[model samples]
Target: MEFFNSGLRKNITSVHPAYFIIGGFIGIHNVKYYYIFLSLIYILSVLGNTVVMTVIIVDHSLRTPKYIAVFNLAFVDLFGSSALVPKVLDTFLFDHRYISYNNCLSFLFFCFISLAMQSLNLVALSYDRLMAIIYPLHYHVKVTHRFMLFFISFLWLFVITVTLFAVGFLTRLSFCKSVVINSYFCDHGPLYRLACNDVTPNYAIFVFATGLILWTPLVFILASYCRMCYALLKISTSKERLKAFKTCTAHLSLVAIYYLPIIFVYCFGASIHPNTRILSLSLTHVIPPMLNPIIYVLQTQEIKESVKKMLKFRGRTKIATKN
Candidate 1:
């Protein structure tokens, strides 16, 4: 009777595993080449984002609400990639597969938080742009550093709270089943699905998070662009229209690079191969961080001028040192 009672208690209690094996890159042929590509991408992402952040920091002229949003985007990109890439290489490339329960939760928390912030950071930028274009007369008065700071701080608070709740909910689940996570990292969906207990709440969290973090931002950005388009059409001359449109080019490029692949994955994820999907998603995470700074440098006139000024000053410094 004691043995049967023990079994019943064991069945009722949560069986949290000590470690989860990261098998995201398993059963794939010659994936080392892909790992090498990730290594290169990570390196570029770090360098590019660092430069953009540095430029924004040092150039007093770039000190505006718009640049603040740009700075946050760069930081978020660096952060998101830093959270994901190194761990991926450690697990898949170096074969450190077993992640402890606490560490796995921490990992998932960081990743989701960064992703949420990335999407919302774009919304912040769109707000800045909307004010500049739609309300040009009051742009200066309306879009202040104080306002952006408050808005971003609010975003940080909300995203952290929701993500913590999501991660916290994982502790409630009983994972008596397989501990091998099939995704590239400690993904929310795959990790929660492995639970032996009912996972309807986790599924609810997934839906809520996806809609809030992904779709909401995209829809808001689309609306902002539509409004900008309508405002631009009122401009009488083609030259004026072109100049206004130029302002949004870099931002639009960034939105495309960051969001399009995600849109594709969402639309066609079921039809795609798992390995292909993983690669595509990974690219979306790493590639945008690399390209974002490049777009700013190339497309934004202010950033371009700032770079030129800095390079000229460096050249003068070199000449002075030689003398």
Candidate 2:
């Protein structure tokens, strides 16, 4: 194990994988410039997700299982961005490319686990919306707080176990040649390419795992939305149907943003132009964290009102305390 760790470290530090080439024109300049952009995105994401989480936790009105799921999604995004962005920023700003082998493995594992959790949370949110739209009377009963807690817990455990297995599989391989990862963070696919040993089993396992994490939830979400649309169509009341449609539209938009780039990158292979890789990476990392908060504020009126009320209350409290 010590030898393996030392070898991994040496391999990773030996060469600077021309990641800028992956960015083409945009990445032409020093990587520090790119890190500046990534840092900005990271700061904004932290603020946005923190506010969302705060709103959900503090506002009693926003404690529904549906919103709880949103909170969890925000939490996942928070950590997911943290996992990749800091290292990326360090690399760009400090020219620090040497992530210890253990840290690299840990980073990779955490990222996948967080991503899987985010995907699972989306699945839960979709189901919650479906229940609300199709079976309003039983929605609350069916998706109790206990149920939400249990489901979220289950997702964490399951994804962690699966991610650990994947990481373990990765550790078994040797890296004889190129140690410099092509991308910013320790992405699984690029890392796999650097392995010296035959990786057929690793690739197969990755395919299965990726399908389970990405495709399965997506299929379920699509099915749920279709059923939801059908149910909405049956509702003759214009107001009721309109409300349902609005919710569905917002959720579908979020789903598209979250899933589409992921599918494109994972399914299509990363052999595209370097510019394409950078764009895909930006979409996968930057856009979703930025967009999710916007989607929630737009789709859920209660959140907007809560923000207004909270601000107003703070303003009044400040005046009263001053007097």
Candidate 3:
């Protein structure tokens, strides 16, 4: 009720801009080169994630609860890259920085939802690993096929609802002070802080998003690994412990590639130059999606084997065709 009344008040009073100028790359020279590199990254991300998903789908062997999480992770990376990259190329490379208010909101929603789901899916993968290692006997009961679907469904709903709320609050803000957004995409912080009216709700959601999506997922993963390590210590055989830990290498590598730059950027963002901050943050978002599938394919024996089987099958079919 208060939200509606506040919306009505803001609608009558707020000076909504027709278009907002994206000034994230305003002063940087030769920045088109970076965007050009990002274009190549996007292509690789698309190809890698597509191959991962295709392998998971085509091979019935990967139909377990664990691969479901892996499939979802690959899908999220692909979806997130698709949502962000082309627009980013157009916005910076072609100098099309004037984004309409509604389009900006839509862009914010998709990008934020993808960002949220990316971390949540990692949380899902971490849970799968934790169950397999820590609760080996109950791994089936704890993370069944049905349970994984339910868990992913619930997380999707929760993430989408929260992202919508965050975007909704921006509608009530009057942005008369400025229409220049200082981030690569329509970042919540720079956009909402530009508003002239009450921004408490918007600011609150921004902080909440940072914690909920960024820090919280990393914490959950780290805690899960700690528990696994503790459990591994109880195993008397060094070989067994190493073998058990080996299963976690892919997930750990994913966490590192995804979270390290992000942590670095947010932790040291202020002291750094704005351009440097943008570059750091941009890479944080872009690099992980490209690397996730590569990490899994190279580090995980299962995926590698599946890929080999598919290639062998394809080669046999080709030979048969020749025959």
Candidate 4:
């Protein structure tokens, strides 16, 4: 009878420790306002990324190779934000943070995959810009649809393999103590803290994986952009040079926003305080998606013109329907 009663109590009291951990970070003091902020961030991110992606897709004139890369980035950001934001909002707002073991694993898996894809896509974008600026004559012929498709496929495959290895290492350990993850999301670093077993292997794998994915690509991007900058300086016409600079500015800004926080968070390791982690994760998830649409619309004059045309068309259609 005691054994049966204990089992019943266990079943009744069982809560995913992730709930408490995330709640602690988000609901640090005021639970109500924290959730409200989280909701606002989620809604804004979804709307902004969605609008950017839709505008790119619907505008036939915007279907260039360059815009295709932008489309891929937008798509990844949309889903990437979705992977964590919704669940996070739900957890904070409603106190419904009951994710099963399987669901938690799945969430972690998708988040890692989406993030890897985003990084890889940025690298591709950098390279595309590099080719356009350095070898304008051969840009079209060299970066064909087939080449883009192949490169994207390779990027996804490489990230997937890395994710599988990381996941394998993570899942091997048992979480017998506090299962709570002390971040806004199920990041490997925070999750590892809850494990009962030795995590040296996990740390080693994480370092190697992150270095390969983040550092190597970052080096390539910086090198390419440096070369592009040198080339831009040589152009004689101020107007053409300004236009070229403007073209690359949005991409560079987006890359900086997306990557700088990530590098800071991971490279700095556990030296950062828990509160710092919460703030960093929130900014990383919230700011980029909200700003990406603004960056694209402001940078690309063609997109601005299209937006004006769209608004005018809508106004005319509304008047015609009323008449």
Candidate 5:
């Protein structure tokens, strides 16, 4: 409460026309190492997501609702990272920290949309898994391609609409004397914490919007997994249970990694060190996206089989040329 009140007091200062993003470093001996490390992460996240999306598009066998969801997740991860990481790199490495008011709001809008969209995609993936496990015989029938398309469309619409509402109000809030953001990106909390005006309305809408966008999907995922556990219990054969668990392992890992930092950043962030907070925030943005394809898609049997077949075909072509 003291921290929150302190933050509030900090907000009640003179307004700045623009803002500077103070890229919080991890106490590295050389800041270049940090920049290089983040640059590697950004590159890998983009490449990984691109590979996943390309595989989904090119591999006709993977043209299903499941892969479609994977594609969407990859896209969101790519979009989200692209939105934040470049700006972060510029701020830290190139000293382009000063962001105009419009640009700051733009960054806030896209980043929020990315976060919300990814959360919703994970929720959709959970439903996909649940339907597969619980309605195995009717999974395709129950979750058609059209249904998935509609669901994804609605998710974008809902998140964008809510994000626009939140960011629109955020842009109206008056920022004070300190134009420097402590975190790497234009996070809503830090931005609003800089506001000089009464933030009660914005804060209320932010909480409600956050709950709607982030927590709602998380609740759905937990509930789905709980039911999945019950369904697994009903399966008489250990083999079937094992198979179900194996299928879910990746999703569960992703869900855990993605949400834990989010919970920390939102709830217990004040208790954490500033450097650790910055690292956690960066990790939340980078780690899951970088790992999603490796864990969820590339490790799957279908992709392995496709790659094997492609390699075999290439080998045959080489043999034919030699002959």
Candidate 6:
């Protein structure tokens, strides 16, 4: 009777002290191929974001508020990918699947922090564009260098405060016996699902934090676009209106790149299997950073001219050296 009761108890209690992240794409016989592919992505993402930062910092002409926001976005993308990708790479390449209790929470914390920063940076970018398009005369006064610096500082502090609150609630949750996490990384949903106690409070707080960090900036971006639209309608010439709309193409593309994957993951995550979800999430982290510079910053007329000038200067110097 005692042995039977013990078995029953084990069956009833599924919570565990620590969890194992099973990782993604277990069906692949050769994980090395995945490693090589992801490593290329990681390398490209870092290099691309770094180039944007370098261009913005070194070039005096590119020091406008718009490029400054682009620089900040690059930084967020670099940091966020750094936080998640190496660990993912290790899991697949090295087969190191075990994560400690505290590490899991830390990972989850930083993940959300990066997310908060990205959303905040997007808001800054939208505001820059909105002011430039809708209120060109007031743009200088409204988006002064000092004002942008202060806004960025406030965003970092606010996001930290909100993330701290969420992590505090996360710390209080208790895990029982079930230790295997389905996702590749330590995601909030997967982590909270392992808790033995009621997770309603955690879920509620997460919803609140998401509203503040994600939805708020999204609303701001949408409003800015609407204002831009109204301003565009006031233009009498179709050619001028089309020209004005053309300026928005890069920003609009970036917004779509960043948000669409996120919406798909959150809304349809349950319907998709775990492995596919993991791959999709990984792509979200890797692909956007890689494309941001190519799509938005590098393609700009100013940056293109700068690159050409630098190349010409280098070629001239090389010819002089040969002489």
Q: What C-alpha lDDT do the candidate models reach, one value each?
A: 0.87, 0.77, 0.88, 0.76, 0.82, 0.78
lDDT of 3 by residue, 1-323 (tens): 23322333433335677777777876789887898899999999999999999999998988999999899989999999999999999998888987888999999999999889988898999999999988889889999999999999988998999899999889998876667788999988898988998899888878997798778988999999999999999999999999999999999999888888877887899999998998888898889999999999999999999999999999999999999
Relative to the true structure, candidate 4 reaches a TM of 0.87
TM-score of each: 0.94, 0.88, 0.94, 0.87, 0.89, 0.90
Candidate 3 achieves a global lDDT of 0.88
lDDT winner between candidates 5 and 6:
5
Per-residue C-alpha lDDT of model 1 across residues 150-174, encoded as one tens digit per residue: 9999999999999999899989899
Which of 2 and 6 is ahead in TM-score? 6
Q: Kindly list the per-residue Cα lDDT of model 6 for residues 1-323, writing each as its tens digit.
A: 23322333443334445444544566646757867888898888898888778877877988887777788888988998898778888876888876776787788788788878987888888888888888878999989888888888888899989888888787777766455665777777777876789999999988899888888888899999999999999999999998888777888888888888988998998898766787788777677777888786554777767667767888999999999
Instruction: Name the weakest run of 10 consecutive residues (lDDT summed) in model 3.
Output: 1-10
Name the lDDT value of residue 261 in candidate 1.
89
Best by lDDT: 3
What CA root-mean-square deviation does each model show from the true structure? 4.7, 4.8, 5.3, 4.4, 4.4, 4.2
lDDT by residue for model 4 (1-323), tens: 23322333333323223222343354356757866776777787788778778787778988777777778778877887888778877766776655656677777888888778877888988988888888889999988777877787798899999998997677776665565556666778777766767889999999898888878889889999899989988898988877787778888988998888877877674787777777776777667776777788888787788788788989999999999
Model 4 regions lying over 4 Å from their true place: 1-23, 237-239, 266-272
Give the C-alpha miss distance for residue 206 in model 2, angstroms. 0.6
lDDT (tens digit, per residue) of candidate 5 on 1-323: 23323444443435546444554663546868877887898898998888778777878999999878889999999998899888888887887766766788888899889989989999888999999999999999999999899899999999999999998887677765456666787777777886778888988998999899889889999999999999999999999899987888878888988999889887888898888788888888887888887786555887667667767888999999999
- Model 6 C-alpha lDDT versus the unseen true structure: 0.78
Better of 1 and 2 by TM-score: 1
Per-residue error for 126 in candidate 3, Å, reads 1.0
By TM-score, the better pick of 4 and 5 is 5
